[model samples]
Target: MRFALNHIAAPNLSLPDFFTAAGELGVTAVEIRNDLPDVLSAWDPAQVKAEAEEAGVTIVSINALYPFNVWGGDLPARAEAMADYAAACGAKALVMCPLNDGTKVSFDSLVGALAAMKTILDTRGLTGLVEPLGFPISSLRTKAEAIRAIKAAGGEGTYRLMHDTFHHHLAGETEFFPDWTWLVHISGVTDPDVAVDAMLDAHRVLVDDADRLENVAQIRALLDAGYDGPFSFEPFASKVHDAADPKGALKTSMAFVSAQL
Candidate 1:
């Protein structure tokens, strides 16, 4: 299944420890983050590469370039720097998330941003994994719109969609485009009391039978439809983050998902 671990799953771990944890869990690749471990603030790309290599794990990608839809001013510079770091760190891609603050962004703007970011990603030989946030306030909220923007931006080869199960359910999207999908972020929402619209990142957790997000169904659909890309765990709940034995917890969740699907 090529399961990959997201640093969000264990934000407390150091970058080196995160790599080692992934290796010990039998995962050969992992998605590192600039958000939590704050590698971008402290460590250089070369240092990150060395740590990953030492742990016998590969850095799948940097977690993101935020508000990538609103490209202007420092956005271009940030995109280029991130792409450069990703390239130097031996990471193959970058996750590009759109603005999610309730402000509406035009379709043309989305297209233009993708077009602009394309050059940066291309130059660094990195794929830009454009992830549509399903939040109501998110500027870009569906893979369909993202696919259209990619086509409009002439980004067929340079960009791919990130199919995040949590966001997918929130988006209430019915169609699946496995051909355009390169990475899948998985997290389950199990709270029975909260309405789907009320759900937040804090509700995201490891999948199980009690999961209300239909994670198994969604995953099976994607796999059956021919998505063979990496499935990365990205639980953001404090419960998951504070787990005493994260590796053990993740293994259990992985086994459950494996059995169900």
Candidate 2:
């Protein structure tokens, strides 16, 4: 039950402050993001590396390279740039998300994209954490599909799955790939009125007794199946973002999840 924090959990906090908060919670691993707080746009890679060291926290990953299944049109350049930044900042991995606009990308394209990105990640000694989006419109909506693409691309050594609890529920995934997973993103959706098909990032909130996403079950299953990794908090709700004491809220949620488990 290793816990970690995602920058999205407290986008308002400065990078150093976020690190400090995680430290207060006895968490030393964290995921930073290029969006939300957009640390990449605001801080130099060397600065980010130095700050993480100063805070005594490890930068587990950079949130992602989006629509990664689309291989052309500057995607390669962007992928290289992100991998370089990740290496420079001492992050271990880069999260890769597929296209989610209902535009279907061929299976060959998915494999080709992964193969191309593998070279970049390998050269930098970084892992590509492929996360399949679960929205109805997502081009790659299942970890099984992602696994096939990774195997086809011969990227098993350079890529791993990012099992996001929210996406897992939305994708209606019944199987767990613990051996292939290196990270897990956990959030809860508690809106009683919102249908499962209608759930969005705005509905994501900290886990509690009212959580409807079965986060505990998902985690227990993963652990039982031999997954030993971090469970990062990634609530995207505005209510969470605007919290007056984000760290306190996160701490409370952390306790609740731990108690339930």
Candidate 3:
């Protein structure tokens, strides 16, 4: 299993410390975030590149440019800027997520957005990782829909799906598209009081017996279908971020997931 760490795994860590922590956990690949404080704001791409190189960590992808399917306002500018940073930092890809506000975005619009982003990505030699959000309000909700949009936009090679376990469950999707998947975001939702439809990102935590999102089953299916790319930890719960020993807790969860496989 190729396990990677997202900056959300330890939101409090400095960039250098996050790289060091991922290295210490025996993982060479990591995902950085712009949402996390001082993670991307304080450093230029050159500094990030140098620090990550010194830490022996590879920045797999930037964990995302949001509302990527909605091409309005400053979205185009933001997309280009993120791609520039990713290319400069030696990151292989940029995770692109859709609108989560419940308002519907038409299929044609989705395809158009993808097609437009494809040009930017190709120019920068970066892959656009299209990740469908699964909230009730989310415009895009399934890997199938993302695949359709990608193919429709002629983005088969330029774009790939981010098969997120938590979102996969929330989307109530059963089919798997392993070949089109570029990255897998894994997190377990263990809140018993929350209904499946009511599960929020805040409910996402580490993998364990209490997990309600079926992380193990989803991962098994992906691996069994020959998807050998990295599965990055992406817990969004504040409890995980505030853990006293984030690395130790993460290692235990990683071990549990590994043993299941």
Candidate 4:
């Protein structure tokens, strides 16, 4: 299994440092975030691309365009700008997230949004990684639903799904689509009493032996089922940042995941 580093893993680290660490850890691919420090969001696109090239790292994907299904006045422009920036930053894909909160968006709306986004992505030779958030308030809650939307949008060749283990569990989705999946986000939740509806991204953490979410097993199953995409670490838990040695912790986690594979 190949490992890809997520920007959330070391949000405090500078872009150079993050890439350096990733390279040192034998990680060739990385996921950049619009919210992370010293990323394309803050730097010039040319410089960001140069820096990534100098660091010898390939950007796997952009973290996300949140509530992407809710296309409105500025949203279409913003999504287009983000897609351009992602392309300039040497990113292969843009992660598109679904709508959340109380607002109701029909599957038809999602299909429309995805079709529009696909046009933008295709123009720039980029792939759209459609991620279905499993939160109760989220409009898109399952990989199956995402697949359906992709088909409805006629995005079979332009878009791919992101199978996030945490969201998969929260959505209670048991189906897997290895062939259509572009990447897999791996993070475990340890809280036992946490309700699925209440599960937040902040609870994401490194996979541990006692993790209740079965992240390792799920990843193993994905691989066994013929998933050849990068398995990215996307822990949002604050403990990782507070650790005495975050890189050391990451190395340990990598070892654990390697053993599981």
Mind giving the per-residue lDDT tens digits that candidate 2 earns over 38-121?
Answer: 988899999999999999999999988998999999989989999999999999999999998889999999999999999999
TM-scores of the models, in the order given = 0.98, 0.99, 0.98, 0.96
**Candidate 1's error at 96, in angstroms?**
0.3
| lDDT tens digits, residue span 177-220, model 3 | 99999899999998889998899988999999899889999999
Backbone collisions counted per model: 0, 0, 1, 0
Model 1 residue runs over 4 Å out of place are none
Give the Cα error of residue 154 in candidate 1, in Å: 0.4
Scored against the true structure, residue 253 in model 3 reaches a CA lDDT of 97
Task: Estimate every model's Cα lDDT from 0 to 1.
Answer: 0.91, 0.95, 0.91, 0.86
lDDT of 4 by residue, 141-227 (tens): 999988888999899999999999999999999888999998999888888888777889888888877677778888888888999
Candidate 2: stretches off by over 4 Å:
none
* Alpha-carbon runs more than 4 Å astray in model 3: none
Clashing pairs in 1: none
